[model samples]
Target: MTNAKTLGQAFDVLLQPDKFRDYGPNGLQVEGDREVKLLVSGVTASRALIEAAIEAQADAIFVHHGLFWRGQDGRIVGWMRERLRLLLTHGIHLFAYHLPLDAHPELGNNAQLGRLLGWQADGRFGDQDLGFLGVSTQPWSRPQALADHVSAVLSRPVTCVGDMGQQVRRVAWCTGGAQGYFEAAIAQGVDAFITGEISEPQAHLARETGVAFLACGHHATERYGAPAVAARVAQDLGLQHRFIDIDNPA
Candidate 1:
C-alpha cells in the first residue's frame, strides 16, 4: 500500500504548485485512506467519476478539476454535497491539480496536445506562461485543413472561425476555457489560436483579427494531464493506478 501523504508530496514536487497561482487548491482536497492501494485518475472530480472510482475500488481519486472553485459556494449542499458525501462515505481521497497540471512541460495539456499534433513547442506566452507557442510539422496552407487535422487529432467536432483558406503554421494554444486569451494570442501574432471553449465575442474577434480560432471541447483538450500525472504518481508510489474517463461533451 502506498501512503497518500508520500504520493501527494511527490506529486507536489513534480508539479511545483507553488510556482503558479491557481484558481482552487492544488492537492489533497478530501483526505481519505492514508495508504492508497488503488488510485483512479480522471478529468474531473464529479459524482459520476467518484461513483466510478468507488466501483473500481479506488482508494484515491486524482483529477484536474476538484471541489471548491474561487467563487463557488463554500457550503456543502446540492450537487457538491452529494459528490463529497460519496467520497467521504467510501474513504476515497480526492487530489486535484489545476494550473500546475496545465503548465507542466511533459504531462501538461498544452504539451500533450502539441505532441499529439506533432507540433514543436517554441516557447510559452500568455498568462503565467500557460499558453503554448508552437508550429505544425508541415504548414497547413488552408485554415480548413488545420481544422480537419485538429478534429482528427482530438476526435471531436471543432468550432473554427476565420478564413478557411488562410495559410497557418505558427500556432499558440491554451487548453480549456481559455477564450479570454485570444487577445494575448493575437499579440503573439500566431497564425492560429486553439483553445477549449469560445465565447460569442471571440467569434467576432476571430473574424476581425484574421487569426484562426478553434474551440476544441473543453473536456477533450484537458483529458490528458490528470492521468499522466496520476500514472507517474502510481509508478513512484508503487500503487495500482487506473484512469476512469467519464464521458464529457463539453
Candidate 2:
C-alpha cells in the first residue's frame, strides 16, 4: 500500500492534461478514492484491464484510451454498462490521457520512440501538435532492419505496409492506432508513416500517397506514457514500483 494522493499529484504535474485539447478527458477521468497506492496502467481501459486492476487491488488505472467516447450515447447499457460496472464496483479510479499523452514532449509516445530510434524530433504539426516527425541523420541498416528493431523494442511484430525492399527516409509517426492519419503524413511528404493499427483503406492510401506505412500495434506503440507516468509517480513519491506490461498483439 502507498499514498494515493501523492501519486495523483505527481502524474498530473508530469502529464499536464490541460496542455492538450484532447479528444477525451485526461488525468483521472473516473473518480475513486482521493488517494491511491498501487496503480495499474494499460493501453486501453477495457473490461479485462479493469478485472486485472481489481485482482491487483490497484488504487487507480492509467490508460491511453478510456470509455465515454465522442459519440457514445449517454446511455449506460450493453458493453458500456458492463465495463463501467466493473470500474465503479471495483472502486478503481481511471485516468485516461488521449491526445495529451500523444502530445507530451518529453514523456509522449512519439518523443520516447524518437529517442529510441535516434530521430531528431521536429515537434508536432497542425494546432502545434506534438508527435515527433523528423529527419534521420543516418539511414537505417534497411527498412526491414528498422522494422525489426521496432518490433524488438515495442515487444510485438509490426505490419509492414510497403515493399520490404524499400528504404526509409524522413518518417512521420504517431503512436497508438493512428493509421487514420496516414494521409496527413503523406501530405507532409514523408518517406514513411508509422503508427499503430491498420485498415484496408490504409493500403490503398499508402500506395496512392507514395508513403510507406507501418502498423506497429495499438497496444505496443502506446505503452510509453503509462510507464513514464508511473516512473514520475515513483520519483516524486519515492515509492517501490514496477511497470507491468500486459502484452497485447492488437
Candidate 3:
C-alpha cells in the first residue's frame, strides 16, 4: 500500500496541473483513505464509475472529469451530495486532472488519441495549446476513409462534414468538446480537423473553407489518458490499478 498523499504528489509532478487555468480544481478533490493499495481510473467520476470503484475495493479513484467544476453551484445537494457521500462513506480518494491530462506530451488525451489513430502531432494551437496540429501516418484518399478508420478504431460513429471526396493528409485535432478549435485549426492550413464534438458553425465552416471535420464522441476519444497515466503511476508506485470503462455514448 502507498500513501494517498504520495500518489497525489506524483500526479502533480507528472501532470503539472498549475500550468493551465482549467475549468475546475486539478488535484485531490475528495479525501479518502490515507493508504491506497488499489487505484481505479476512468474517464469520468460519475455515480456508476464510483460504484465500480467501490465494488473493486479501490482505495483511490483517478479521472479526467471530476465531481466539481468552476461556476457550478456551491451547495452540496441532489446529485452532488450523493456522489460525495459515496466517496466519503467509502473512503475513496478522488484525483482529477482536467487540462493537464489533456495536454500532456505522451499520456495525454490528444497524444494517446493520436497514437491510437496513427497521427503525429507536429505543433499545438488553441487555448493553453490544447489543440494539436498533425498529419496522418498514412494519407487517406478521401475524408470518408479517414472517418471510417477513426470510427472503426474508436468503435463509435464519427460525424464527418465537408466534401466527402476531400483528401485528408495534414490534420489537426483536440479531444473532448473541442469543436471551437476548428477555426484556428483551419487557419493552420490543415486538410482535416478532428475533435470529440462538432458545433453547427463547424459544418458551415467546413463547407466554406473546404476543410474536413470529423466529430468523434467526446467520451470515446478521452478514454485513454486517465488509464494510461494511472497505469504508469500504479506501476511505478507498486500499486494495483484497474481501469473501469463505464460506457458513455456522448
Which is the leading candidate under lDDT? 3
Identify the runs in model 1 with alpha carbons over 4 angstroms from their true place. Answer: none
Q: Candidate 2 residues 1-250, lDDT tens each?
A: 4544555566777777777766766666677753566767777888887887788777788777888667568888998899888888877778777777777788777787777767887646544475467877667645667677778877778777665556777888888767777777877767777788899999887766557788888877787876776667666665544455667777
Residue-level lDDT tens digits of model 3 in 63-90: 9999889899999999989999999999
Q: Tell me, by TM-score, which candidate is best.
A: 3
As a TM-score, model 3 comes out at 0.98
- Candidate 2 overall Cα lDDT vs. reference? 0.73
Q: What is the TM-score of each predicted model, taking all chains together?
A: 0.97, 0.84, 0.98
Worst 10 residues of 3 by lDDT: 31-40
State the weakest 10-residue window (summed lDDT) of model 1: 1-10
For lDDT, candidate 1 versus 3, the one ahead is 3
- Note the residue pairs that clash in candidate 1: none
Candidate 2 root-mean-square deviation in Å: 2.8
lDDT for residue 225 in candidate 2, whole number 0-100:
73
User: lDDT (CA) for every model shown?
Assistant: 0.90, 0.73, 0.94
